[model samples]
Target chain A: MIPTIPQPRLLTAAYTAYVVTFFVFLALPLVVVAVFAFNDSQFPSLPWEGFTWGWFFGEERPVIGVFHERPILRAIGTSAFVAVCVSILSVGVGLSNAFLFNRYRFPGQGILYVFMLLPLVIPGIVLGISILVFSSRIANGAWDIAEWDIEALRPGLTLVILGQFSFIATISTLVIAARLQKFDRSLEEAALNLGASRLTAVRTVTLPYLAPAMIGAFVVAFLMSFENFNTTLMLVGSDAPLTIAMFDRLKEGSTPLLNAVSLLLMLGSSLLALVMIAFQRRG
Target chain B: MKAEARIGLILLLTPLLLWLSLLIVIPHIDMFLVSLRERVGVGEYRISPANYLTFLTEPLYLRTFARTAIMAMLATLITLLIAFPVSYYIAKMARGRTRSALFLLCLVPFWVSELVRTFGWMILLRETGLISTLLQWAGLADQPVEMLYNDAAIMVGLVYTSMLFMVVPLVTTLESLPDEVIEAGYDLGGTNVSVMREIVIPHATPGIVSGCIVVFMLSLGNYLTPTMLGGKDSLWFTELIYSQFIVRFNWELGAAFGFLLLLLSSLIVWGMLRLTGHTLERTMG
Candidate 1:
């Protein structure tokens, strides 16, 4: 409903307050982490003990404290590796699924689509547990039958990537499918009529149109995979992802170094997003 | 029709089919089998319905499911309430660069991880945190308020996380409404409140329902928010499921709980579609 006489000033003031408050809520923890990253204190809580760059690039041999932890770095690297793999796998799978579903009409298509979406509806914890138990059982049963040692079935990087890909691919499919729905089918038809093969038509016309959406889907999937904790925590064997590492640290006790790690992650993601946004603008 | 097209379809579907089979279908089949089995000592399985029967008969597990359902409903309702006005403001009142900027601001929270975002609320609600400090400074409380690690904090975290999901869809629908229709209401001597109640609300029903469905499903499935914000003793249904499988090594009971959650969410999604007069496919699309 449109009011005849608009309360412009009041509306603007209220909106400004809301926006400011939202940003405050969003930025407060980040600001805390960024500030605490430079804190020389052992604790994550306040009562600062001056400023130091020890956390960021500290160089003492076998450095003690939270700054020089090997596991934390390893976890971060593992998370990055897993995220990349999941992103590539999800995007590839999602794109093909999108193309098939969008272009074709087939029997039980509705049922197939529902099956695809099952992962999104199911709880991550349940998925993780089921995958872990199922994989272990299969590995053990196979080994007992063959009378051979098979150690590769343990949950680790592979399981983490697979678990994340289960749902993240669904997200990618939905994003790309939505974009595809708006695509000009006539463009592809025209390309085909103008002597292009179906593959050539898709490559020359449809693929370019879907590029931005695919990229967006990739970024979103990658971020989701990277930040995923529930599935990763359940399925992680010996090597922890970054989120699990942080959770372990928090369980032990909160330290400024944890905050420092959070700060680094925040900075890393924000920079990546900024670059993507800039590229989008240029394109 | 074409051989190449047929082959393309097969190639496209093969990976997805294999993925779903391995990761989803196979695991679910295994879960169903395990659900029929009983835990015999540490890390052993035996065929029995003992765990399922226990979940059904036990008051604690039953109560946990009920409470989780109630909490999820409350969270969905609260998110809808808060998101409606904000979505309306953006979709109706704001325009030009201001609207785009405001929309971007709404999405900025998505950039932060859910774990990190929940952590933000934890810091705010803590004894020595900003909220407590503010209340103390304002003389509204003699001491810092004890608002953290409760059902209320859990609701806050859930609502905050699911809010954007509600807002985005609402904005899409509300933005689609023609300004002329709204102005015509005013021209016909209809009051603003009546116009909204009679016109805008009806038009926005589909979006509201879709948003509510998404938010409800997410809230019902959420585990981390309740665990972190509500603490160890929260007794959320998902947490119960997690405990059963991870801590107790009881897959059967966990499967029952998981099935219950899936059933509830599906029913809610069905109800949402029926109420909005839209199919699930349309709403999801």
Candidate 2:
């Protein structure tokens, strides 16, 4: 109800304080990560040593404080590569699935849609284990069928990408499907009536309309793939994704270099998001 | 359909179908199969009900499941309690740029990974961390307060991660409420609290239900927050499952635990749908 008086000043103040504190709680860790990235100390703790950019651009230490390492860079590259592959595959598969489901109603459409969401509902660890078992079985069965020695199929970047795509595609499909719901079918009809082929009509009308959502879907998919841990952890081979690498480091014994990596990733993602937003606005 | 359209549909449906069949359907079937099997060794699979028996017979496993459910419920409730007023404020009172800015602030955390966010909480709640230091500095305690690596930490992590889900839907639903209904309540001499209870709350019920369901499912299925924050002795159901399959190489027990979690979440989702009178497909999608 619109009270005769505006929100009581005391109430507003209290609420404001609560919200401010909540945001502080939310933001503090990120701030700590950023701040400690420059600390000269090797550990992620308070009483920062001096502000130094050595972690980002520094010489290596032989024994312990080797902040600038090639492995970290290689892990980052692997993560990017995997994320890119997952993004493209998921987007492609998701967009097509969305198109198929939206444009045509099949006999088992409802069942199919539910099946698409099954990956989302399942526990990540279970999904990972199942995939691992299934892949191993396939590799074994193939070896038996060929009656020849075959290298054991191990979990690696390829399997990780596949594992990620299993669910990321589902998310992308949902996003694109939501966008497709409001799409005006008459535009396609009009294009078709104007002597354009169905494919041409879709290319001109449907694709343009779904472009923004598809882009958003791609970004979400990429982020999910890149930051994924549970499934990646289970499926990761000798070479690890950045998230797994960070997790392993944390579990063993973490250093401020972990904080440095976190800050770098945060900055990279934020910049990417900003660029996408700017591009969308400009377009 | 045209030949090209037929071809396109085939191309689109094939990979998704293959993915679902291989990754989802087959694995679930495998899980079910494994659930009925006997555990032999670290990574051996066989057919038996020994693992299921372990879960069914053991008080520890049952207690873990019960504890997980109770913890998830508490976290969902806490998240709702914390998120509702803030959502209402943003939806009803905040204006223009302030509203947008606050909303954006709510989403800013989404830029970071959930793992990182949980790690952030771990940092703050650790015995020697900020919270303990602050409490000591404020003279509330002689020694640093011990907070981390417990059920409370697990709840905090869950709530922190799921807060946005509760807030966003609540804000959207509350914002969409007709001003006229609120005005009508006021014209009838209703107080702010009365109007909120009668008008605002009822309108926001769908959102609240959906939000609760989302939070509950997420919390129930959550493995990371509980494992990381709850520490070794937490022994959450998912962690138990992980230990069985990954550590002990007991696939049957792990499968049984996985099925229990799945069944519980599915039942909750189903019950929520029935209670809210919303279709599961619509709500979840």
Candidate 3:
């Protein structure tokens, strides 16, 4: 079949060139990152002093591979922990939110819907700092009033989860809600008509329909949490997430180790992203 | 509503309220309050506009804020201009597997952290980096040219970071436009430019607006791209906010800067929506 909006020959050639350039721009940095990960050098940039997997598996001094690096490994663990926590919390809250928006009508629903979207528009740094400031105030106020030492209220993994959940829940809600809207209400109705309780009907009928979207949202939430920087940066305590950890190391200087970790991150996230796309297609 | 239904409604509303008030609403209000207060001394505070006043009066802060706003706008505009054709090529020109592959390619780079992306740019643009090395090898320059730590480098990084965001929205919008409409335009004896300007752009307005808004917000609030690529002298407004909060231990000043950024971003996004004759809801959809 002919393509839509057929162009003149010169225009077609120009568009082809433009598309090629765009993809090259997109792929170049990632290729460079992956390539230098194996470089047998201290620096990430290259005159390509031959290839080796030293950055990924080395044990020599100053050539510590990512697996051999304690702090980097700890940072990755911290990031995974935070992502898991954020994903579970976001999806749980998102389910309630989708149910609220789709299954019920309430006063000020329109305004509340708009407010739900505010987090999406607000800058991540803004959300992070605001949460940081507000929680610190509460923590300090508790100390002044009751001598309560709620250390969890301070900047830490807890705050990171909360800050990430603030926006990511919105995304999950949108995803699940999109799926929920397309659901045939009559299936639940039929289950209810067959002497099933409301909860039973929902559990058996509705939840099954939403399974793919929920899984998709979970993967997406995990990816966003793991890759988040600005928000995580503000909320991090001593237990820094991967992004913060990488950022601190970057400020110090670039290392092939950083490239190695990045290559790993790229691989991990791409797999998760592919899972999300597959679920989206299936759903 | 019945009592049980009312209870269920309240149950659903609980999470939404807690999320909005405890997380989004109250924190923002606290931020505003903190912005208006200045710490006079230890365990002492005074309500004042002095923090904001400092921002306006300080030449460095004011200049950085202006530079950041201008740069973010330019980045947004550039992202739109660049993404439009690529998105069009994917949504209209490419078929089946090619379309999906192009779309997936757009997403692959973003899977990594922004730090990694910045690191990649650093490797490409740094003094001892590949491009400079290439230049020297080609005898195009006598020195290893420093490509990093400048506004242009910062712009490149910003544009790169935002391209995927713009492309996603534009592609979504463009995909929904029927091919028949464009064919009809051609049948009406319209040139490519005329059809594009009159038909294609009008159809993609929502996408363009949403993409611009997201890109502008991202570029404005971006921290890592500017700092990593443009170095310490980047003078990006977000970095100022960051320094005030983290380095200077001056939360009051940082809070003020944060509010100013929030306000400015809101105002700009609102203005864009109004100019484009779209609402946040409509464009977002």
What fraction of native interface contacts is shared by candidate 3?
0.70
Candidate 2, overall lDDT? 0.80
Q: Write candidate 1's Cα lDDT for A1-283 as tens digits.
A: 4434454677668766875676576467567666766777666544567887777666663224344678888988888899999999988998899998998877888988988877876767778877887888888888889966566667788888889999899999998898889998999999988999988999989888888778877888878888897788778878888888787776676656676677777777777677667655653
Task: List model 1 lDDT by residue over B1-285, tens digit each.
Answer: 598777887898898789889999988788777778876787677888787788879998888888888999999998888888778878887888988777877776767677767766766677766678688889998887767788999998999888889999999899998888988877788776888888898999889988998898888888778987896556788888788777897667777677677778878788778866897666765
Residue-by-residue lDDT tens digits, candidate 2, A192-215: 999999789989999998888788
* Tens digit per residue, CA lDDT, model 3, A1-283: 1265555788778779989999999988889999999999889876788988889999988888998999999999999999999999989999999999998887899898889889988999999999999999999999999999999999898999999999999999998998999999999999989999888999999998999999999998999999898898888898998888888888898889999999999999988887787887887
Stretches > 4 Å off in candidate 2: A1-5, A62-67, A147-153, A279-283, B1-8, B39-46
Q: What's every prediction's RMSD, in angstroms?
A: 2.9, 2.7, 1.4
Say which candidate scores most in DockQ: 3
In model 3, state the lDDT of residue A155.
88
By lDDT, who's the top model here?
Answer: 3
Q: What local lDDT does model 1 show for residue A81?
A: 92
**Residue B259 displacement in candidate 1 (angstroms):** 2.0
DockQ for each numbered candidate:
0.48, 0.50, 0.69
Question: In angstroms, how far off is A220's CA in candidate 1?
Answer: 0.9
Write down the TM-score for model 3: 0.98
